[model samples]
Target: MAQQQETKSEPFDEFIVDTEDCEAREQAYRARGTARPITVVGNPVLHKECRDVTEFDDELARLVDDMFASQRAAEGVGLAANQIGVDLKVFVYDCLDDEGVRHVGVVCNPVLDELPAERRMLDDSNEGCLSVPGAYASLARPDYAVVRGQDAEGKPIAVQGTGYFARCLQHETDHLYGYLYIDRLSKRERKEALKQMAEGAPRYETVAND
Candidate 1:
């Protein structure tokens, strides 16, 4: 996912997760998982909508763990399953909100909620993706957003946030739907972003599309 610069903190205090416990929880997942090479923009897996995650078994659990490892390895705040070449509706995030409060969790079969016009406050901030490697472009996204999904164990949950965390949630969801942030840009902007990627190399291992 991308690092957002439009962190206008909203008062969603009731939605805040247990950050104190998140550090230990995040480490436990990362500890049990192996980091895999991330898939780049041209990969087929990243171009199509992902399959829904039906079985909440050990395999799914392990995938979540691996996603956290992969996200950390890529130095990204959030990642979707297809980002690692898995065509499943799953994503993991370890991001901080506008207030610098850390939130960590996994969402399976995630769905973003439709925001009403009143809540559609556009935050035009620069965004970058791990899959796109070294490109970034300013995009307009609602500062406040919400998502409904299940946990690693398949329990129902809803997560909402403001600023950077909101962008993380929205970004990962878009990945599962086979839409990169560049997809939202103008043709010129999109071409510019791809050109930037062509000129740079990712620090971490990446899966070559070819």
Candidate 2:
């Protein structure tokens, strides 16, 4: 099991959703009927670099809807298209920062702006992923980030944050580039994460096969 640790500035909230709104949206989605099965760590889709989303058509719109539905159903704060077996450069987030302010958006073909070297800060926080369910690891990531991308319709979209939200941005963007949180871990930490997965992955077999 991953040990808990407190941050100097703010405590971490691992992929927590806004309960009332998230549940309502999930219920609505269930009523309407659509949920994409989340891909797991071993899936090739999770390892391949996602392709840039070019045509913003009705198909893209529907994909965005399904992504949101799938994310809400899984109760995750952020999700990338690759996590759902889609090889597109898109991600959605309904995450919160250290102070509890909600940040929500869809980012397609994102370009990340990491903080300058002097301003960069690292936080070794416990992080989890929907794709790699039932396992968590302490990954060190920059404390702030800015991601510029587009909406489902290709309109400009940018999101910047600090604390956990910054971690979320980095994590999702990494997914677009064929990376996972475990890939950021040190060798020993990666070994522990893999062991945890070997033990707990069976619980998610049904979801993965879906």
Best by lDDT: 1
Candidate 2 on 110-186: residue-level lDDT in tens?
87764556648888889988877777898888888767678778876656778999999999999999999988888
lDDT of 1 by residue, 76-168 (tens): 999999999999999999999999999898888878777766889999999999999999999999998888778888887778878999999
What's each prediction's TM-score? 0.92, 0.81
Which segments of model 2 are wrong by more than 4 Å?
Answer: 1-33, 201-210
Clash pairs, candidate 1, are: none
Residue-level error in angstroms, candidate 1, position 207: 0.3
- TM-score: model 2 vs. ground truth: 0.81
Could you tell me how far off, in angstroms, the CA of residue 57 lies in candidate 2 after the best superposition?
A: 1.2
User: For model 1, what is the alpha-carbon lDDT of residue 17?
Assistant: 66
RMSD of 2: 8.1
**Native-to-model Cα distance after best TM-score fit, residue 112 in candidate 2, in Å:** 0.7
Which candidate wins on TM-score? 1
